[model samples]
Target: MENKNRLLLYVHFNRNNQLSEHVLYQLQQLRHNFEEIYLISNSKLTDGDFVRLTDSKLADGFLQRENVGYDFAAWAEAMKHYGFDKLANYDSVTIMNDTCFGPVYDFSKTIEQMESDNQIDFWGITNNRSHKVKPWEDKEAIVLTDHIQSYFVSYKQKVVQSTTFQKFWSGIEILDDVVAVIIKYETAMTKYFEDAGFKSAVLFDTRKEDWTGMVVHDFSVFNLPELLRRKIPLLKIKAFSYGAEYLTTPLVVEQLKASTLYPIRLLIDHMTDVDYPDRAYMLGEKTLTFNHENTSNNLLKIAIHLHANHLEPIPEYFEYFNKYVQDYELYITTDSQEKKAAIEQTYPVSQLKSVILTESDEILSWWDVATKMEQYDLVGHFCTQRNEDKNWLFEEVQQREIKQVLLKPAQEIFQTFKEDSKLGLLVTDVPTFYQQFKTENLTADEIWGNMAQIWQKIEFRKDRDLKRLSNKSLKYATMVWYRPQALYNLLKIDIKKLAIDSGVLIDEFFPAFERLLIYVSWTSGYDFRVSPSLPKERLVLEQSDNQVPQVLGVDFEQIRLRKLLKELLRKVKKIITYRFKLKK
Candidate 1:
């Protein structure tokens, strides 16, 4: 049996006193390796809270107090409680904190590798050596003070028993200033150990000559083979946050895909969902997987309608579909014969079929081009979706959303439609976040009204098949895929009537088409489906013949207005509370 005396001191600091999923996973990894684990959290957690951790064998016990000294202070408090001298009786002392993610691959692998290197008196999973100007000092300091990153560090029995180690903890003075505490405490630990004849080492040393003088290297491109050879298991969560700013989110994801971790896609999801707020759209990264079980028999045909300007993005999508998807047909539709000829030459001649349209108008081009190419099982429609008024950052985000969310899910989306015959129209239901929805400058109810009017006008034979024609509220999205027959009523609608009205503040015609398309599907004996379900209840028509369309025509406007009023009231409450706090 392993020595019970071997202690693992884990420092945790959560401002809310609530444990997050990532933090809990980190604790579970530590418990698997170390039997005697004591937690020191910088929160005034009650006995009931400790009961959960203790019951799960996540902690032997924990110390709760006001968060004053951060992780450094927590470690010192744990040492005092355990008894400074009594800690020397342990085989080793592993000091860790909830500062990162992982033991991503396996905790046992990291432990086995670290145990092999018995000569080292102390070691860390990673080391900090980035060059930065010291706040306390005037000169730029190479932040490497021969220190191991304190996030996860282990010390041998000899070092733990040493006078230098005991005195260092005993003499630590917790300071109010965070920078001072970090400099005097965190960075000082490794140096103090080395100075007292304890050999210090790291699993993944950043100061190694292989580094190309970058302030921060992208962790997504972290060499897993090299990490396995060197025995580095954990990834710093802050590395992705740094990558999101410095290296870009896409590159971070690209590098993560190459790692040895199981379910790399889920890891990327956690990065976008849990870690980086700016990269929430990257949750669609997993949609890139091709899960069409029987692609051999059914061929997925994709067509791209290109506008006059910036048809450059068309080739990339064509190439992506050709490269990744099997048994897929590619078609490009353009008004200009010259542009069509040029695009045909760029891709493999046999694979691509170009449909040159007589009409120059964007919607007319889609109608004529799709009809000319015979009928496809699935038809994908996309507008340029560019806002010349917005900055490049916004443009990049739009392109990513289009490419990652819309284009990547093609095969799976096609399969979803093929499996269900009743499912005619498929559109991605992007949640109306205030940050995004407010930018469009169009209310949901206003869009709803425009669609309702267009649907009523377009369906001339509504009385003939009144039972089939039921209204389902649709979200405004540019990218869509649907069965060709779904647009039977839509194909009959006169293009002249869709003329932009100058009286309206917004061009309601084109925007209304997005919603009207869903109505057309319903009238043509087909049901529309949204990828993610709606956030709130709206008009949704099920595939069942007996089921009635939801009562959204009149009630939707009132529902939207009430929601707006609630939001305004919340803003007003926040403003009043801020002013009240200012008076104090």
Candidate 2:
């Protein structure tokens, strides 16, 4: 079965750039296995754009035009002529594609392998296509005269007399011809070849299973030595065996994972002298190199590793108050098994088919699809610590507020807290209106840093205030501090002397007002005007954090003073109730 002949390799590439070049090199490495090669490129070429054929029998074929309609017709004619020439030159023939190509086999030794009856006509790398249709009903690779576009190999006579070949050369629907020929000719080629008393089949989708059956494991990406590692991946174990040290650190771990799954992988600038650079490059002793055979499929495992750590259920946060934490599921949109594995191990997965996403356009800005499925106990939002979490909550709420509109609500709260007396305590992470109060012309990054600094200072003051209260065993006005340090500082004083650290404002004023109503009741008081938690008339209150400013009686920290003041309101309510009773 040792058949020595050329593999008339043809590739019709689009604007693949570096990826194409690297694959070409991979093909060069594969040249050693092929007796000769004939490459026919049918596309527009740019300056310095090139494809190299190393098997000495390189015949670079070109089309006549750049226009798709015109170029396609010319390419079809060229393919017919080239197919004939390839048949006349080499006993065996093959064709490839721009996205990927290779696994140049020992055709001279195992040419008989193509003669197997079990082999298919068109081999393609495909997954399940649609959400509902049976996978077989959806498009998959066919190995015959039809669907032979991406990769195909056949005998010379079959190519010369092909009806599909004649129709392709006729120049009608040339673009569609590329697609249709693969579908139509797959069966035709299989039947014709068998009738002529030769057997051949397709290796569908270049999957490992297909290659295993053929027993062609140690093949190249054709010729590119370096790109061999990319276009045709070395076995996963082989990658782990490369003589290198993995420089794993905390920071690089997350970035490495996210860089692969999300588009951010493109942002990482590959360093020449670094150990374990991204999949894109390898910087060795003296050479800094990049492999153009970069594919997203190249980093599947890395992505899975990264997502596993941060994934918690959408309802994980509700755990503190409502016990019961169970695994949940997510119905994702993509059909990629690699991505599905990454998401599933890291996060709970829901088993729902993907719903069609209606992208926003000028006519419609919102879309919603709802169904009552009892499979899940409850429906809620999923959140990420990143801004995405907040956005998810707001997206469901459907509340869009401009900066001006948001300011109105903030101002109202600030003013009411300033004037009102019945409220108590305020404890929050940071002021909601901190952004509005900052100096203008600051960048977003600087604004965040500044806010952190301000909060730090508040925490320090709160600490000092608490220690003061604890010394005398006297309680302070309501406490409010947002940072971790602020919480620690508040603990300096006893809870009895410290403010509740609850989120409320103007609370101190309430207690003062209540005290006044009681005093007035005891005396026959008439004209009463009181100062706001004024010093001298002030009560000493310990703040939750040392950095928070100490205030006179009317400051934030007065927890239930408003209830005593409300004694006056209680009398009014009693009067109303008595009047109603009398009327009744």
Candidate 3:
């Protein structure tokens, strides 16, 4: 069953300036399947990677040069040297590049299936035809004849030895642009082979899938079981080019689990090393790394700031705070001594780290709490802006963490801050769904007019700019996990100046601070991200490491679904209550 004459030419581009672990992993998966392997790079491979590749017993040779004609050029260069005159000796030749990630599941069975069928003169991992679709048309009008995507394709001995194969590759002009190369060589590859009467097959042809056409462009994680069952190998990494962000993190995880795939998530983690690092980070991967122990020691201090008058304390907040005491110092700061005494009576004194009294009833009492928080690495201000409803405190406090907050281990939370020096603030995803704040309508000029004086005080790192704040804005009742230094500029403003009865200026001031909070993070050479939902990769990693509590039956999907249903029911109840009041 072993194909003695199979040769693989792996064309790689070192886009990250280093040979990536994902690429190496892909190569390792491929190298053993072929008798002879030529590892070619469009850019200089790192010494370590080059040595590792060359050391492989399967590697016949390597070609490294400046990036010119993309994968097409790399393929042609190798073909001229090894494939042109020696095609008769080879049974099959695979032209592949590190444009995808996988063989997460083995492809030997799939390869065997294709080899057994002599009808397949040429074959590939997957095929797409959206290129033929007209701009106005939503679906492709013609059958996608380009039976194989250029990412990975194998030619049978008859096709490889034919004049058409040699002539087509020999005529390949060394184009400097990748787009031109794709048009001239990659797209034209199928036409040349087919015209010469060669039949082709793809392991996972998009035309065969029942899923919508848009799904074809993605790894189609939802269709993973079928793809794996078919033994399809390799997932197109570039397929996520424009829309990685649009794909929700949970769905991505589900797809990964369904596919039984691993490397793509790793790619997502180090995506910044690639082109879309920010998108990868947002899509719930740990795109940052740091000294974990050091970071944990300096974890953000948490303070529950309250100006209690007569509201019953949220005991759940204390339970949540106590759970992460090893990672964070919790402070219960209130203006009312009576409120502090009541809270202490409800919770054991041992659990309540420190209850500081500001001794003031004014709104500016938070400034005293803020001052107390300044000495720490970061501070989380958990204060209740609404007091009438107990459910409001529970809902708001529960949102203190992002969606699926249970997924984050306290140590990992501290590690996230340490890993990204630029991440100065982490705000829980804004509860902006409420009608009061239409974030889409707010603009920069509206948010910050006279606030420039307050902003100018904080010394920002010279390299960073805050121009983006003028466009992007956020909304939430102010509960934030913030770096005190990141907000040093806004906090330095006189507390007396900030207090007002209620007007456009008063409205502008606090909301402007919310907007300013985002800008100062960026301007001060620090960054802010809407604290993400549970990171899928983190959960998977924990599972793999056996850190998960198996006894709990903690199904993430079930938990997410339950939460969603609860939200829906809550909305329905609110609607019904409003209607009942209107009728009355």
Indicate which candidate wins on TM-score. Answer: 3
Q: Write the per-residue lDDT of candidate 2 for residues 97-212, one digit (tens) a residue.
A: 43332232223233344433234332222211111212244676443322222344444435445554444445345444444543344224444444645443443332232233
The C-alpha lDDT values of all candidates are 0.59, 0.30, 0.59
TM-score on alpha carbons, each prediction: 0.49, 0.29, 0.57
Alpha carbon lDDT of residue 377, candidate 2? 25
Which run of 10 residues does model 3 get worst, by summed lDDT? 542-551
| Per-residue lDDT of 437 in model 2 | 31
Which candidate order results from sorting by TM-score in descending order? 3, 1, 2
Residue lDDT tens for model 1, 1-584: 23234578987766546665566666776676775888887866666667778787788877776778777787888888888678888878888887666666666755656655777888887766544546766656646375677888888788888888889888878788887787888777888888888888776676654645345442223433344455356766555555443323444344445554534444553453333322322323422234424343445564444443346666566655554344445555566778666666665556555545455546565666656434667766654444557465566465555555455655677676767686677766543331133245555466555665556656643332211222223344446777777776676665555444424533456666665665566556565555532322332322112122222223546767897999999999999999999999
Off by over 4 Å in 3: 1-3, 51-60, 86-88, 128-145, 205-231, 242-252, 259-264, 270-584
Clashes of each: 0, 72, 2
Model 1 scores worst on lDDT over the 10 consecutive residues at: 543-552
Give lDDT: candidate 2, residue 252: 29
| Candidate 3: tens digits of C-alpha lDDT, residues 441-544 | 44456555534544554465443333422323334525656678777755666644533422244445555565566666655546565543333233211111
Candidate 2 off by > 4 Å: 1-3, 16-19, 33-36, 46-75, 83-89, 104-112, 115-149, 156-172, 176-200, 204-584
- Winner of 2 and 3 under TM-score: 3
